[model samples]
Target: MRAALALLLLVAAGTAGAQMYKWKDAKGLTHYSDTPPPASARQAEVKNFNSAPGADLPALLAEVARSHPVVLYTAADCAACAEGRALLQARGIPYSEKTVSTADDHAVLKKAGSPGQLPLLLVGQNKQIGFETATWDGLLSSAGYPASSALPPGYRHPPVGSAAPRRPSAAERERQAQEAARAAAEEAARGKRPPPPANAPPDFQF
Candidate 1:
């Protein structure tokens, strides 16, 4: 009888230890949280605890950058994506932001896993889909990435149109024309012109 009582007592203690928590949010809305909320908050019932992604921000970015090509797969007009772009630009880090919105972007989305989520940050040969602040910060840091908000010196976006300037200044044009004329005159003086047709036969030798 004593052994059975001890066993029952152990089961009761275990159940008590696994109690659910409840709390209220600032909105006066009562909520449940696994971890301690602010002063006004209380613990919530965590149906099942999950191992959250925890990473060292800086180290994560360094490692992630090396193995993964930073691809910010974001949709157009996405505030997070825009902020993300600004963040990357500040760091002066090079990245290909595939803005998806139109049909073309949709095609890219299909390949990347459409019907998913936006602001999809990829790195370290692995693509992390979703909006997890901790995970992203860790990945960026691991990749040795500069602070996302740091600006690169002398950064300028190339203007649209021809990459090389097509219009030359008047001075430049005249200079080139003069050079060409001088070169032609030198060729003529060198007597490098072809001979008359009468002396142009293949059988004729110089």
Candidate 2:
């Protein structure tokens, strides 16, 4: 009887150690379960039940955030953008900011269905082109964010980044420069002129 009890306890301990998997499908749907995600699932993450807490975010807030991530798009020298950011901060909504400052950034914004609009807010699939306190509040509430601040003390949102793809690191930039220099030297050796910039007008001489 003692040996049988010990075996049952071991089985229980093993069951308790099962990890959870969180992932997004090709359709952009998020899923969470103890079982492993499908091979096709993107951004899959295994969460250990016994892991120490990092951010200590509230359970409800974390759940809501996982289901409906928030993103805000802003531009420099825009008053509305500042106000929108302030509103989100006041509400303790964890969100990432995308700054639209370059042509590439603007192109990405347009692709996201914004016609070069500033202060755009995205809550899951919902889009708000402009900032309005009531509208923004409604969207957050609809997305299951708490009405009042639930963010932990000292918690800070992610830093703002450009809407364009991430810029290469310094090492990558140096490597590219060296490659360009080598190519230029090779072209000069062959008595050939390097191509002009892509944006150069057809009539513009190299």
Candidate 3:
């Protein structure tokens, strides 16, 4: 038993001495070899594991987001928009969605360089007008996002547009107050009860 154990330890020591070389060619493809790579190859720092190109994908992707934020422009009742959203969510991409519901929203979309297309995805200044899984995947891969779902379970993204309460701007608040007053006056002219304030909380009687 002692002799067999000694032989196993010798084999293990030999295996540990085996050298592996890693390098990248001019075209930026990673190569791994047991033999030394060519002098022209860009030798990568030796690591225990075979490191692929973009081995530090998560950190690189985070840096990309800081420099080139992702934005998804969507609209309600749009199937394609839902699919595009699902794709981003499945890839664990952090993005902000701008809903094209109001005229102002449409204007914002246009200024983002979309040609009135639905499901427009913005990667930094780069814009994708329509949702195509292959194309979107390729772009996301190039941006260094992981190619698979990495989201934690029950990870709720910010509620879809209109589902979350939004703070109104000062100008919007004033405009809403004016509209409310106009509505109340119109209701009074009809001899009906005036409506509650626009921002009033619901009063439920059970």
Candidate 4:
């Protein structure tokens, strides 16, 4: 029940449009607490909502294109459509927007193999529809976006060198993690610092 409640709280914090709360426990483990966390623990867990979910992709790509070239196809007045534009602007991305407000616009989108999902982003040789966060992030990342938030700010992104691509192979990541862990453990043992938490029990640290 506690875990379920925590999950729901996390979801509501994002979906019901509430602020996010964060905290770090005694063992350097982070947690999201609805209430304020300790002040001196490096960082307390309390922050406002980043933004609404499901952004308009075309607009987002355009904003990213401020640093690159981006193309978009969109119609007017769709809620998702609005989000698409807002996202691009928020990220400071500049793009070429082709409004499909007329039959010719509709024909252009169809001829270009784009769906009628309003914000259709074309980054390089790729085309994506809807507000797929991972896909947008990947496309923008590939097209040289300078580390903008694809989603609202609270949504996490991967580290600089490590990208969380859409449908990344889990096994490959696991194997790499294992290899890194083994290397770290070996280094620690050679330096007489125990095993360096290689086989530390889950949830045992925090």
Best-performing candidate as measured by lDDT: 2
Each prediction's TM-score against the native? 0.39, 0.59, 0.49, 0.38
Residue 18 lDDT, candidate 1, scale 0-100: 24
Candidate 4 per-residue lDDT over residues 40-88, each given as its tens digit = 3444533333243543334444344322344566666767657766666
Question: lDDT of candidate 1 vs native?
Answer: 0.49
**Cα error, candidate 4, residue 102 (Å):** 1.5
RMSD of 3: 26.8
Best by TM-score: 2
**Candidate 1 lDDT trough over 10 residues, lowest sum:** 157-166
**Candidate 4 Cα outliers beyond 4 Å, as residue runs:** 1-68, 149-206
- Measured on C-alpha atoms, candidate 4 has an lDDT of 0.52
Q: Candidate 2 — which pairs collide?
A: none
RMSD of each: 30.5, 21.2, 26.8, 18.3
- What tens-digit string does per-residue lDDT give for candidate 2 at 96-134? 778998899999788766898888898766789988999
- lDDT of each residue in 87-136, candidate 1, tens digit only: 65666544445556566555555555545467766553446676665676
Model 1 TM-score, 2 decimals: 0.39
Ranking by lDDT: 2, 3, 4, 1
Ranking by TM-score: 2, 3, 1, 4
